[model samples]
Target: MTTEIHVTTLGHWSNSSAGPTTSFHLAADDAEVMLDVGVDPVGRLQAAGLSPTDVTHVYVSHLHSDHVGGFANFVFTRSLLNRAGDVPLLKLTIVGHPSVLAGLKELLRVQYPEREFDLAWVECGEEPVALGGQLTMRLVPTDHPVPCYGVVVETGRARIGFTADTGPVPSHQHDFAGCDVLIGEAFGLRGDVGESIHRRGHMTAEDLGELVAATRPKFVVPFHFGQEYADADKRAELLSACGAAEVTTVDPVDAKPVIIGG
Candidate 1:
């Protein structure tokens, strides 16, 4: 049961990067799961040859425009496609804290004045979410200004852990241990004010290096790059710092989409 995890970069790091976002597509043979739908995620899905209708579950990291920018679009697409009877309105499960969900509702009212949903919100205080088959998500708190949660997502044989936005490594680093792949946030490069000046909403490249040092995942995918450094150098620096993990940076648009158990 070797599970496969596919990652697609819906959001990449560029000088004029409109949305500081990334979309992950993790699937197992037949089941499909989308993680962190943000900043034109629906458009990114389309660009990756997928539809919002294909997404079964969406696991959010934290409540930031970059992370959740595509929520309204995803919801709007789903609502437009599923007309209360179109294919039974695919069960879209959003995993996050209760307050985070609340904040989203407030955001929706402002973002999409004519938006509604026939979905379920899983406020993962402690209980994990079973995404129908071959997939489950367990949440762990991360170091962010607001209440944020990282995810330990397991689908068949592949386990992908994500640290959305963290100041540095999570204190509970052991929680996401033994994952096949880990996608950590590297907002800014080392020696840059990305560490010293940011309001703790994002992290610096050095901070992600700490994540690699603390958690030894097989592959470390560095994402959420700030407009300060080239992703290539940032990845190299992070990998060199880890010394044990294979680090890869995902280009939100060009990176391959992960298809599990295929």
Candidate 2:
């Protein structure tokens, strides 16, 4: 069973990248899933040679606009883009925390009073939910300003962890222990900016580096970078702090899929 992970969008909210906001697409033998749906998620999927129906499940970390702004568009396309007859649209399941689930429904209800899609919402707790026979995922609370979670996805062959918009939390290392790939967020460098400037919201590059070093994932792909850590030199410095590990830096605009196992 092979696994393909694509970084659809590679920037934070304030980034000027050509593509949409930060999102990830995970394609495995068991299930096709999306990590987040940022702005222009449909466009991002098109760029990745996929359609709206290709994504069966979406795991939303939080209710930030940069992360879930494209959710309405995604549901609308999947609901209406199908055959205009008796054929039903594809079933799209959205998984998130209890708080996120409530906000999500209200967010969509405001735009779409008459819900036409066969959408399902699942609330994730401490227990892991089996999306497929070989795919299982669990959400762990992270240190963010709002209620946010860092997702851990485990496949038959590899385990992938995504630290979505989190501050320095030592427990995350244990949460995502022994992952094959860790997709972390580095908004900026820690020492570069004043320590007080980055507190409780996003992780700095240095902070992520230390976290990665503790977990020691096989590959570290950092995203959600800010202007301070956007340069190649700055990114390299961040990767260097992770000790000796394979680092694949995703481009801010367009990037090819990074296959973890085959």
Q: List candidate 1 segments past 4 Å from native.
A: 1-3, 12-20, 82-88, 112-115, 194-201, 231-254, 258-262
lDDT of 1 by residue, 126-180 (tens): 5567766667788877777888888888766778888777666556478767776
TM-scores for all predictions:
0.82, 0.88
> Please, what are the lDDT tens digits per residue for candidate 2 over residues 21-70?
77888777746788878877788788778777667789999998888888
State the lDDT at 77 in candidate 1: 77
Window of ten residues with lowest summed lDDT in model 1: 245-254
The residue-level lDDT of candidate 2 at 178 comes to 90
Give the C-alpha lDDT of model 1.
0.67
True lDDT of residue 201, candidate 1: 59
Task: Judge candidate 2 against the unseen true structure and give its global Cα lDDT, from 0 to 1.
Answer: 0.74
List per-prediction Cα lDDT, in the order shown. Answer: 0.67, 0.74
RMSD of each: 3.4, 2.7
